[model samples]
Target: MDELLDRTAEAAPQDLTDGAELRGSSFDFLTGPGIDLAAKAQAFHAWAQTRVAHGVFPYAKRLGGRPGATAELTLLDGRCHAGLNFSSQEYLSLARHPKVCAAAQAAMERYGVHSAGSTALAGNVEEATALEAELGELLRMPEVLLFPTGWAAGFGAIKGLVRETDHVVIDQLAHNCLHEGARASTPNIHLHRHLDADHVERLLKRVRQRDPHNGILVVTEGCFSMDADSPDLKRLQALAREHGALLMVDVAHDLGCLGPGGGGQLELQRMLGQVDLVMGSFSKTFASNGGFVASHDRAIKEYLRFYAAPNTFSNALSPVQVAIVRACLAIVRSSEGGERRERLMRAIQALRGALTEQGLTVLGHPSPIVPVMLGPDALARVASREMAQAGLLANLVEYPAVSLNSARLRMQVMADHTPALAQTAAHIVADALQRARALAGATH
Candidate 1:
């Protein structure tokens, strides 16, 4: 494993140099006397320029310039096309709902655009408190806390909950946020094979053998955003209980999509009450920008509220966003919301079936997110381009998001999509797949 990783790392620089040339530029004035900061800045800028020149730039070219790509987006050529937006995390199409938008607009009128301060500061504590309480109830947790974003939520929870002496076992395919957070928070971290509970048990036993006094935390995601699959939560909960470890599940992708009542995969598995901690993003299903950690224990919630840097330092969620989320929550909790969720599931199934009939390989279970496996990076990029041309907006996910040679198209189905629209999207994606296959065949 180490040798393979080393080889990949060694090849990264070589790959960067294939299509671009790097030129050395001098900055004598910036490095001259009485310019300490300037020298450092110049050095960093030089490194950055070299990276970009060597084809290591990470930013995707934004061809479609639009607020939301449900119908059309203006591409890099400044032309409009019928766009299928598979990249958005808004799984339920609640972002553009009239109720959500109206609430946001009303909140803007009531409290301006920004939160203006952190939650610990003079920001709207009332809204924060209310949101935490509402989230707690929705997630079946005793208490809840919010962070500025999902990245911060993961980082804060792992760091705040575990000590250096604690053993953190994570899924191999867990989101980078979880792995990175655990790595930053504790030195004793082990990664197990994806969704393999037996591997987790083996690692837990090894950790216990090495350090019997150390605490253990097992981490996994409810629905993997990239692959759209879920871990066996019931078995995971039982394993955590047997090992005296706490289990943390990130439900960013499944929070408003899965379960019997839209609570998530844990809920669907009837293990919601078994998991120790649950974290999810409000951005996707709730159609709001923020992240949260929900727990049955009050102490844990209080600890994170004070210890989490993002919660204490970052500005509170904007009042408008809070209002929007509040509205979304109301809608999701009602019977009408159940109907919407059902519609979403049906749409997902329909699209998946159509894609399968068209002979395209789709990953994961029959979830709202249907990932079309395109294999190579070049093929994935070409398929994405073709789909865009055909009036479907799909995301071309490549390396770093998934393993090398596992590039795919991540298609997210929304509740608002009609049957015709969903079928049309599948056909467009199928055509795109054919084109990509043809191009690859010719090249080979």
Candidate 2:
């Protein structure tokens, strides 16, 4: 225990006060000085290596095979642990579907895996074109443009359409990509409180008073990944319309995983085809690494094809990737998709209930994510190590990823997660927390 807690020999006394404390290890990478980039990483690496030795680092554990309710995780020491997996973000469990795999194989046979060029020139394939049409139909939008990844889609959607003169009114808790895209394009960015439509309204009104003629793009997410909550999109869209602003919703986490026919928040809110722009990723509920943006105007599609650097410069989604997503979409729209959503909801409820029964404070509303809040950051690190050792694998989100002293476990569920697994996992988590709190309490 002494060896596990000792600082590295070269660590300065200041380091002992900083990263030697458990709370500082997670922030070095986030708040570390960028002037000497390698120095920042070196400091973080020193602190993180100690966490690894203590088996509490809990990042970048390689997977052994296909992901599901349970998976084989290979730790840093080359030891494999098979545990109840709650780390994967796949809500639909479609990654290993037989039809999806078969579609990939067929597309590989036809297109030889790669798309061969960027979509702006020669990489556009028939499968992707058909996918765009299908997504347009599913989203109930007039046009769709595909991107290489979900991140690219979010970034490009804002970067492509909004000019430097345009103002962006975004949620405070919006995804990093959206913030980065807005930062890259313009300096006129206003952030409102998270999920506060009234704040959005005030910001919209403020921006209009200052620059009535300039375009204002209102950005938000359909589902916040960390907290498992959603916003009132209907009121937000109306606010944007009243203020003469464009509303764009990023459905990366919820699309194809929520709402009727897997149409996501817009559909459930009865605002499908009503928002000015919609963007989503296939990696969440669908079975591929791709994304798309939908709009009610054809000009947006044509404009993005040429203007969006990701679409014009980057290689389009491979034929196999497109085919895999196409197959997943077919299932997402069918009666089987409805059944899977029901199963997913049940699994979500079961896991949340199990956690609550264990006396853990579960955050936000019920969704695939059940955030079990563990405070003080230090306790979360200890609890993470205990959970890993106890053969229960889940993500340990601490400072920077969340906030200081608000660390929590973001347990993601799949459609196929069984009730028995949920109950057992909850027990393991509870036991881990008990033991961790005792050990951390004794350390003082």
Candidate 3:
């Protein structure tokens, strides 16, 4: 069965071109009949090698400097391309902010590089402690706990609070770390339809009828990373409360990037101090690498600090990282933050309008992420290569990252992106897609 599927997965040998790859999804090599894990990796690696040779493999391209409207990208072959970059997730364009950089330098001088030890031991710096307090204040859920990375925070929040017997009712399109944490900790995970609060309520009701006593964590996100859509948080929270469940919203992609105060979806939905649990990563808009969980109960914060493996076993965030976020938080809460948010929305609208003008389908709301649908895996791959050649950088997300054959270019918008830049990016995207469609059609 696997062999039969493989035959139709990639582009036919006769259809090969110099800059075009053998089209296939990550799902193709994800599973196989093998006891050794290396066997599966080998199969995937063999396939990926073909993509690299054709210069169409989109992942893991190194950035020469901080990501901005115009940035440099280094491919695996050591070839460098500088162009209008819509790849990196620097929403507020704060990664290289003068103040952010200054804070990092000062912290480095005082504490040196690396946290040196796990927080469970001796790595809790005063900055991290202070940052926790600041985040707590912003969220209005005065109890907070921190983790080294955003992934760690999401995973830890789940692994720490919920027991194996507890139920995890999550959105089907929630982030991978959230899903993985749920799978690792519990067997009774119920995935509701994407962004459907009604579906979640149905699952919650069903779970309560069967296991009313066990804890239920209704997991979701603020601004889903791929689709850029948001759940009705107010409704979801109310439903969770009615059914005796706790709602945990991962705001990794939204916090520090949305709202007038940069409080993200929680603030937009007027849920700042109301939700049961709010967790988010600073990497997206806060210009650093850290994440935190904000809750109303101080006891939950302390409980997670000791119980969460990602928190207890892993090292705390470095002083430099802590300082960067502190500075960014200040910027995110100021009038300047509001101005940047306005500018960001303008860029998003401009890009969306331009893409739409070119007959492309732009998904979701006017968020930092702009997902332009391309439809087929082959077209997406070919278009990605064409975009690179044309000096435009945007991510082509196909199966495994998205649904099968529902490929799209997930462009990350920056606050500093000008209207001119957006228009130029749209033209490049349209031209590339048109060429890809023409080429693919010819091959068929």
lDDT string for model 3 (189-209, tens) is 999999988899899999999
lDDT of 1 by residue, 185-206 (tens): 8988898998888898898878
lDDT of candidate 3?
A: 0.87
Least accurate 10 contiguous residues by lDDT in model 2:
7-16
Candidate RMSDs in order: 8.8, 5.0, 6.2
In terms of lDDT, the poorest run of 10 residues in model 3 is 4-13
Q: lDDT tens string, model 2, 1-444?
A: 123123112211121121354657455576565578688778778877766655667788888788887776776645455678898877899999998899999999999966768888998889889999999988999699999999999999899988999999998878888998899889999999889998998888888998978999999999887888889999999999999999999998888878878888888889888889999888888878989999999999989999988888999999899999999999998998999999998888888899999999999887777889999888888887777666777999987878788899999888988888888889989999999888778776
TM-score of each model, in listed order: 0.84, 0.93, 0.95
Lowest summed lDDT window (length 10), candidate 1: 3-12
lDDT of 1 at 81: 46
TM-score of 2: 0.93
In each prediction, how many residue pairs overlap at the backbone (N, C-alpha, C within less than 3 A)?
6, 0, 0
* Local distance difference test scores for all models: 0.74, 0.84, 0.87
